[model samples]
Target: MQISRTTLAVLVVWLAAVAAWLVVAKPDMKTVQILAGEMAPATMSADGELPQRPPADADWRPLDQRVLAGWRDPYWLRWRSTAPAVQGGADRALRFSLRGASRLYWNGRPLAGNGIVGRTVAEERPGRLDIVRVLPPSAGAGTDELVVLASSQHQGLRLLSADAFAVVAPAELLYGQAMLPWLIAAFATGALAAAYLYFLAVQRGRRRRPGARLLLALCAVGLALPMVEGWRALVGYAYPWHGPRLFVLLGLHMAAAMLLPAYLARHFGLSVPMGVRIAYPATLVAVAAFMPGFDARSAAVLLLSLLASAGLLLRVQGAQEERGPILALVLAGALAMAVAHSAFLDGPYFLLLAILMGFLLLRHAAHLRALDRHNAKLREERAQLSLQLLQRGIHPHWLMNTLTCLQELIEQAPPRASRLVESLAEQFDRLRDSSTRQSVSLEDELALCRSHLDIVGLASDHPLSLQVEADDTRLSLPPGILHAQIENALTHAGTGACAQHPFRLRVRRDNDRWTLELRSARGSAPHRGRGTGTRYIEASLATAYPDGWRFVQGVDGADWCGRIELTCAS
Candidate 1:
């Protein structure tokens, strides 16, 4: 029951999302409905004083279900509170909407007002549509009398008023209203920020691509949409500027429209069409500019449809990586959201961010996979290097002979013993360096090979000589292959420890191939047993030049011949 790092991270993210949802949605708080009826006007008096009771013959009507359902005009409402105002303390506030110009009163006391009410379009003034008024704690609770005077008059409007609204706990009302969008916005912002930095950190590495930077930008800007809206909800949509949120929403939406097609085009390696690249956002601007006859949301949706269509085309074009699939899913989600609204996904942030974060996670998964492969390859190469280093001790089978020869040299000939010691030290050093590198220069390899032959000559009665006939050029090849061949020749050639048989090494290159030939005077056939030398050489060749090398291990007509032919990779 060990959880992978990815799963653990996902779980932690889920927990955070849930916690944020709880805080944003305020699920535990109860909403007490403070008002739920149509409004009536107070009795008028000559002294400009309002009466406490409504006149019997006053023109009062319950907000018609049809009218309230399709409300789009100014409305005045008077509600008698059923409970004390600000029952949960001044920390609570009233939450409702009154479009155009409006004023509110509590028990004949002026509470708040936005803009000026007018009877005609020319006289009308713009005001805040959403309101949240925290009760002054100094004013004792139990005040229930509430009145709202809303006026909306414009050339495009016909109705005088629409309907009275409701009163609920500010926390409960705003939270419940905006919970889903806030959840999506918060998660998207967090995820995209992390993913953006990940790509930025690894652009020099082999994982993240350059085009993904556009996706990061898309997510970053898309995150702002729901955030702007959700913050408006959190603060009861209270703002001094008129229609600022509306303009902000349009600008962000239009930016997404522009960014979406661009990201999709770059990711799938296609050209963004002229229409989507130019006309899509252009239409949004036209609509917002013209104002009266144009439906901005509809225009925006059409532009978004262009984005979705581009994504679909990318999917059809065989761009089926994480980028393609993720783009398709997001575009499809956006379409579903447009048609189904909150039914498909609750929030705008989640709808747009779903694909962005999905793509980010896919990139993370790819990065993890690449890193694992890199680690595994490093481990395997290190193992092979250690093996090659270990092969140096294989001549220990004649260890007694070498030691006996060294003892004689030390006692009878001090000069030869010193030369042997130096050769042995140089051999170990060469082997150490060769083991650590995949390839070494021909000159260096030849030096190490001669050191091995000299060391072997000390223990054997036979003298060893080296002959290299390359065309005065230096080349690099995988180390230890030729060394391994030399070791094999010495091991199985059956040259007597005290016999005077000489060995010669020759190297020459053809037009495209390198040839290394080792000959033994005894001319023993190659060992057929499953030995380490043969396997190591074959593995190294396959790894370095899988399709361009040949290794033949057998005896020539008169000598034990082991030769390797290698062609450098193009």
Candidate 2:
């Protein structure tokens, strides 16, 4: 695929955004754990008051587990840990999660309260699942103390599990809260690219190439799969909806299996019978619908779905001995993808391909724009050339000369007069045909040159001879090029100096270059001005051979010679 300017711009912008995000949102992180809540204060000062003096080691109970799990009654935990030494003066924070209401105290002083930590079940309030409480710079260092008075909700004898509490800086939690927003932004962008590519494919309709639309469609579908799979933290939906999220993921996975095979069949010309096609997607849907209940063995459903998708692709690929150039690019791209997968172990490979597919779509759009411009230019040039051809044939000078010659020939020889008129008409017809074409075969162009010579030969006082020596008549050249050269020769050659003069046109191919040489009698000055035959030939050659061509014209001894060498496609 071509790398377009737009692709470069997008990459640059993405990199810049990443750089800016890193610079502005630099992580000031220090990880320090102060909580292994295993506590029941031996002496309580009062219900709503702190102990005047900190409790001794003998007053607290130390358990094996860090969290206060399987505990249903209201309890107060005075979590204490010696302050870890600070380095680099990094900013500190206290982050924790709990199930029930809680109030926090730093160094035995009342600080922040979340909901209401109550002694009785009736008075209890539920706390948030997650919390981040920043510690002041004056209090972050040395001998820190936190008091979390938590009450677990009692549902008969069942104990509600509570998340452990800890103190750490935001940045220390690497793929923690900060990562969610980035993932969301990345997936949102992928969705946009997918929609745009699909729109392009649909807008192009029948003009869209095989596999182009399928590639984009697969990319769009594949990108959303990871978002659905990771919605737990990425979207932060309610935990109770876990079953529905899993269902959505399985459904998407099944859809991908169908689409992947369908792309292979459509793009690689796999002869999938109608029955097989219908059965394939049907099987995927059934598998999705009947996925095993969530358990250790339930992972087999996803593994099986992957097997089906890959199985279809391999089956189709094996049937064909021939593959397209695009298939080779796909393989090469997959190889690159493998390398990246190794490097970015946690990267969502499917969504990454969406980024690549976006670039491909841009390249396709650029290609289409270039082709459209070229076609429009050709149409314009054809219209202009057609008008020029009409005027050339209807020129009053040539018509009057031909008619006058025919009148003289009628009195002298009627049969010759009829021949002259027929040749004139044939030459006019060839000119009209040549005018409509950008290129013509050497044979057809030579025929036009010969007809013109015949008509001109009849009207000239000095006889004109024509000689064409070409090894290959299969080659194509710009239309009217040879004719224009011959016209220039007739207008300026002989000069009544030579008794007899012949116009010569020679063509041959040497290696990869096609050579055409036109030689007329040498003269002191050029016969035509810049805007006439000379300019037309130059313009036509430039348009046809923008590069890889040589045009040399000068007087060689007694001949005014011009040679054009054009490079052929490799």
Candidate 3:
């Protein structure tokens, strides 16, 4: 039930089609004609009579006169009457056709036919007149007269026959030409709004909040205003309106103007300044003042404020590190709307605004999809890096050292060394099996720790103890992330020193975290400079877990120790 950007775009196109139909499809002359009265040539000569001619040598010229004066220019016949005639009938129809263009007058009223004069016609010569009509019995026959005011600026003549009049009703003329299209558009827009609201409600149910829903609701409201206005124009309900309807329409327009900047800023990942929040309410008040008097100055001020807000949004959008495509979409939409607003009413500018807004909405949706994809890719890479780090940490060096010590102890004392070799081999096998995995069980890591302790104990003459307290349940941790701390302790512990020295290794797990502490007598301090082992460990932690792992090392007088804490994988 969602009204996606694509759906809105299609709706916009549909509205455009409706507008085109209204502008391009000529209305039926029979339906629009107001009266069907004949005017003799002599009768037209008198004032207050039908088909009256222009004043002798009158030189009133059409605006943009050059456009019609080109080759094969069409001409119009003009006439005037003494007073405006009111034609009355159940169906006031006056139907007629001409070659190019013609004007009409009733009782000295100049029905200019300005709408048709500027139109171009193909396959026609100059001085020809086309057929046109004005609808309903708005002009009547009591002491009233009718006239046809025609002209051919290119041909420099203004005379035509009286056979061109036809009577028609306004309601019937507009029924097919204007009102129908407007009705369809109104229904479509209503459908779109209902679907959009349904989508917002569903999202609210899932997200358990109304903020996103309210934002979308505001967007729907913005789109609805233009849709309704366009419908009104199509239906011929725009002029001579009731007071309340006009006020509501103006208020809705103001709401749309205020909502647009906020919508664009949020969509493009730009910040909306606090100043805008304060200024928008003030704009609302100014827009409300447009009632009863319709102040053009206040409207101008509101427009200027909107432009300023859009400029502020552009400034913030320019400074963003990402979201370039989204920003570009919003900027392009704003520019298109600006150009459209400045053009004439007949230029279909409102339709252009709809198109641009639809594009911006599409861009916003695409940006969100792209962000989700990027986050998924990051997660995959992290898993891969964690596995690689585990493999590197539990390498062949530790096993080789344990085997060499076992070989030496085999000759000196066979029984204890034999038991130590078995423990070392078991641990090496465990490490080999787990090195390729992303996470190893805490029990497995503890077993490896035990093997390491055996090797260190056998290699040293002094007393060395290793203890591990962890639940047997398989808690997962990256390989070698824990072992590095144990190795650092051994390297600094003076394994070849006098017999009185002692060393200890302890590992414990509590809840979701694992901690390892190693202590030894410092016969000589190891190089204080950074080592490859430490650097590798740190780098791996940074890539795999970021802030999830920590390592600390310190020397207390003659005692050297290291501690590592890591969050276990689920």
Global lDDT of each candidate: 0.58, 0.57, 0.48
Candidate 1 Cα outliers beyond 4 Å, as residue runs:
1-76, 79-93, 99-103, 106-129, 132-145, 150-164, 169-184, 204-213, 236-242, 272-303, 306-316, 342-346, 349-351, 354-570
Among these predicted structures, which one has the highest lDDT?
A: 1
TM-score of 3: 0.40
Q: What does the lDDT read for residue 429 in candidate 2?
A: 87
Q: Rank all candidate structures by their lDDT, best first, as comma-separated numbers.
A: 1, 2, 3
TM-score pick, better of 2 and 3? 2
Tens digits of per-residue lDDT for model 3, 1-570 = 233454454555645654664554456654343433332211233353323355555443422223333312323333232334455644433333332344556445565452233223332223223233453455456543444433323333222221233333454563445455454444544554554555444444221211243346555654565555664344323111323344555565566556656655554456666886787767667656643233332244335445654575556634343233324333443454455442212223233333434444444344445544554565465555445545544457765766677777788889878778676667658667755665666667656766666666765644455544434445565556556555555665445541244455566677767676665555465584156456645654544454356877677676566666766444
**75-118 per-residue lDDT for model 1 (tens digits):** 54666666666643544456666545667776667777777655
Candidate 2 lDDT, 241-292, residue by residue in tens: 4446555655554555455556656655667678977776676556555644
Candidate 2 residue pairs in clash (backbone atoms < 3 Å): none
Per model, how many backbone clashes are there?
0, 0, 39
Model 1 misses residue 401 by how many Å?
48
How does residue 50 of candidate 1 score in lDDT?
34
Residue 184 of model 2, lDDT score? 44
